[model samples]
Target chain A: MRIAYIKNKLLTIDESFVFRVKYQTNNSILSTIESEIDTVLSVEHSEVLGALRNNDLENEAIYIFREVAAQFERPVLLFSGGKDSITLVRLAQKAFFPAKIPFPLLHIDTGHNFPETIAFRDKLVKELGVELIVRNVQDSIDQGKVVEESGKYASRNTLQTTTLLDAIEEFKFDACIGGARRDEEKARAKERVFSVRDDFGQWDEKNQRPEVFDMLNGQIELGQNVRVFPISNWTELDVWSYIQKENIEIPSIYFAHKRKIFLRDGFIWSAEDDVVFRAEDEVVEERMVRFRTVGDMSCTAAVLSEADTIEKVVGEIRESKISERGARIDDKRSEAAMEKRKQQGYF
Target chain B: MEVLKIATAGSVDDGKSTLIGRLLYDTKSLTDDKLEAIEKTSKQKGYDYLDFSLVTDGLVAEREQGITIDVAHIYFSTPNKSYIIADTPGHVEYTRNMVTGASTSQAAIILIDARKGVIEQTNRHFFINNLLRIKDVIVAVNKMDLVDFSEARYQEIKSDFEELMGKRDYQDQKITFIPVSALKGDNVVNRSENMTWYKGQTLLEHFEALDKEDVYNVGTPRFPVQYVIRPKTEEFHDFRGFAGKVYGGELSVGDEVVVLPSMTKSRIKEIYFYDKKYQTATRRSSVTITLEDEVNVSRGDMLVKVGDLPTVNKEFTATISWMDSQNLNLGNKYVLQHGVNKVLAKVENIHHKIEPDYSGVDESVNSLAMNDIALVTFRLNKPIFYDTFKEHRTNGSFILIDNQTNNTAGVGFIE
Candidate 1:
């Protein structure tokens, strides 16, 4: 098909200053131009590219992304070894190429992560040659900054917040890029793309500044850092599609496989070791399973499925009756489990 | 499959929660753990049958009062579509919350108790949905079992709603009527065995058949620059790009573009979605574009083609939905947030307080109270490029923030 291209002359400053100037252009030509430019641009960095490619969310991802990349003296992608964070890493790479990712990668270790996720996290940082800063939740617990919960339903999801806040304070990071999507949780739905946190790292959900067209309000007093979600609008399906389209490498546990798992509180608990408590009433057995979301191994449950391939997994998600959070045991504690955690600075 | 977002509004005891409970129960969307919790909670409260409202009504304050205070998002899916129900409060005090919930929704379900045919709450619910331009609305006259599946009552309420729809600004909205007993699991997820007079699809069946066209899609593309992504790495150190999501339309490379405020002109040099480039970036994709020329641009600036310019002005008229407890009166200064731009604005005129019951406008009103929707005018400190809310949702709408408290006091849909 012949591409319709709109090649108009550039305007001088005094010509016009309106925000949006609509012009007619061929759809095919526009797409062709995008493809042609992508071929020539050398996006060596991984983090920026991950974000850049997963661009099917909010329109401002590309525009504010350029601003954030330029504004900060030092910026970092908070990589969690999760699909969302990994995608941010790739976007950061393409964001700044030739030079390594402009800033270091920070990881807040919960001390209870799946082994494969941790392994993948290390490999990614090593391959990208960017500096890696790891903060431990165990350190926070040991220092009495956070207390460990007792019993079978215990998790370190809330403890990671302390470690994350400490790292930000220690590094004085002005802006921390996150992979949180607004569609994932309700409290997050109320969050701004450029959410401001006080020196104490608390989200003022009620007073968020209105976010309008491509501009992000990055104005904040000193000691107040910003939490920027580049992919705030991307749903679970969009992320998976981008992964499949880019062939981005993920942990093996995401695909279906056979493993020894036990049903406790009606969730598929991995029978890995003593890291997770087991009750005598629960029956343990080996079963074929896969994880939809990768969180703290104790809290993240496995689902019964045969979606071993990316295409199959995407298809399964499209037709699945239950929500992605259905496999999570932690949320079963209460209706506002996620909201309460977010209020206390848990990301 | 497409995603459908619906907002539910009804009276305090109109079985709004029960209707939602029935949907989750009949659809089998409730997981085993969630079901167990509901059963335990319901039994503890000494209910004989499972009180489905226990599944939702999450807030501690709400459970204590047995009422929904805020909007709670509930997710469920059928074979063809995924649904997000914004369960909003029915009380008049929470009318603002209802509007907030319905603002993003494509459809709305206004619940009516079978015993109480059509009440004032129903009018307010319909009014907000109409004001927000929700395209599809379902008037679910709940508790049909109490009325013995009476078709006469259903017709009465449907006719009442038709009278209210006459006052709506948008005439193209499609409104459907359904009668069901939420407690008996009839006509919510499955076709009712009792309502033989009803010929339409069941609630779930009706929802499954809706295409994207039946919903309120995003308006014209509005690209609000969020942040700039510039990685000054050694290999390609000179690369500069603007990053943001496109609100309504697609942007492509090699398009003649103009930057806002500065009005710098440039051609789209490259469009990067990670490493690979595409010909066009569709609505809502966060991509970076490098301009062909080295025009100076920064945050809070917009980029678009040369001919399609929005209205650039410092003042305009708007319809405001007052949210705060404080009154919205003339001469009150507030921060008007238009897209990503914030400008100081003052209330220039207060035309009238729009009665929620679709009654005639009250021109005597001088100020708007909480939950009051009014048509007002404002004067901004600086020129804000915008379009009518109907033309471009992203650029046309705005929020009002009280300068003293910094609270989002009101929302404005451009006139």
Candidate 2:
């Protein structure tokens, strides 16, 4: 037996003399051009193969999204116009591709949101053609459901819970999908992927149902709804990496830009919006900064950075010595701030 | 990057939280602000060293009680792999939390205090891991600093644990032992200088060296339809795809498949993961698959390779880990959730209870209480496609939900 090497392609032949004669009769120039084309095809093929390797975080999130659709009749995505919520929207889209996102988005607005975030949220909702429902904390305040806190560190972040619960009751939503990652806060670390809330929307952190394997128990009472966190296993770094890989669009506040800011309690507070309360002695300065997280503008802090692009933002997050929630002033209020807020129905 | 899920189990004061904090701290996974808070809290409490347990005891009640009541998930990553550790408490509903934590994990770490080596809690932890069929297990003998970092002490604990290992029915489990002081950070992320007598790899090194490919048992591919994606748009007017996550094994484009329950046969036309079409959908990848022929498939239906069909049955016996406060008695009815599918099931019989301390099963046991592991038979309202727990983990398990309260009452592994 003999082997014929035909322009980088290997073929076996039994007769060596016949193989040599066949090779001479073949067009060498055409074979060379064909081999060059094969090289290009292989390169493109690997790129596709690379994408075939799905990120576990993305897959699990999408699976949870599908579960929500299958389990509940009235499900809603709790969109905050943040990167995490934006990522959730994309995952929801992917979960049911070619089809529109099966559920509408519910946004519990504090009315103290970054203008850029609101603009971005409206634009995304229009592009995706998904219904957007906005509930205002100001309405809750007006209805005497919640009282506005007035102080130097006062924020409307905690008051959003009342409005959120009201919205849940109004829509009778059985599942509210949100992008609450476990790695964000300690209280969140103990949350189940399909967390069940009572009729009053209270999170029973201590007595959570056991979630075994990939089995999610979405069973609930008539008035109770489950708070579904698809990205419960995802970390901040994973979210940023996924954003960069998918080239997902986020709020402009996430990227570095010239902004008027002030320092308070060792954190940079954006002064571009009048939502954030400032002291009389506080001095404002112009700095290139980006928000590591997007919450109510009153409580969310900015980090000084030059990461204007998604790639640069991811790179900065990888090397940064601070956690994503470190800039969240609301969490800094008390030790169990997140837990306290979550118990009151805050997503 | 690949993700590695792990569960930590030990008795109270076994330093499970400390070990997790040490892993996060040594890997530089903890941010500067978190460290500062830990330091500030530790000093305020008049502790000589920083109390790393504060990092995981998140709930106010847990902090007040100084004991973990619920499982807390901690995340850390090396350059190669990311780790998610479910730190569970070892008291009260120990078995319930341990089972909950270990169910999603590929590996588990059972911590043993060097001074109190291989106690009853250690036995229970090992028993749960064995029952869950977790492949990789690391038995870390913590508080080695208190034991003078004695190799002899470590060996004594290792041999005692080995004795327990002999009693385990699941022999495929791979167990590794390491001596460490999670407080002083020895033999955890870095090699221990105090225990130079032990020449094995550190806990982190051993985990890093593990073959990530064998984490989940690879069985025949089973695609449980989660949702139906029918765009009904102008471009994709007739497009009807069954969206699901492929479990166990890879599913190819042209593979002959049979829809479960209905038993409809069809060939896969295409496998779509988001926008791009793939020739094959690998295990655990959520993809939408279109069949060559339109099949009346809906949620709760499963797609499996022809000739690789699972057992379809309306009644089965399973080992149940009851987690509810109410006693699980025979003749009781509950909602049985198998993956995304739910069916009403009645407790036909209570066979026996297996003690978690390596003792033999109690044949005369009648009912199961909280944290009780027992064998029970259930008759479902409808037949479900299933597999044995030893063969396919995901398909082999189900959760019992209380019909009235909707609480997850128990978790069952099919026999």
The C-alpha stretches of model 1 lying farther than 4 A from their native spots are A1-78, A87-105, A127-131, A147-158, A172-246, A256-274, A277-293, A298-340, B216-222, B233-238, B250-257, B262-270, B290-292, B326-329, B356-358, B362-367
RMSD each, Å: 8.0, 7.4
Separate clash counts for every candidate: 80, 0
lDDT (Cα, tens digit) per residue for candidate 1, span A178-216: 888755654555556777778888875644554433435
Alpha-carbon lDDT, every model = 0.74, 0.88
**Residue-wise lDDT of candidate 2 within B252-292, one digit each (tens)?**
88899999999999999988888767777878999999999
> Residue A234 in model 2: shift from native, Å?
0.9
Write model 2 residue lDDT over A1-347, tens digit each, in one string.
11113412321222223323423543234334435543554455533322245478889999999989988999999999999999999999899998999999999999998889999999999999999999999999999989999988889988988899889989999999999999999999999999999998998887888888898888887999999999999989889877865769998889999999999889999887888898879999999999988899999999999999886787798789998899988888898888988998888
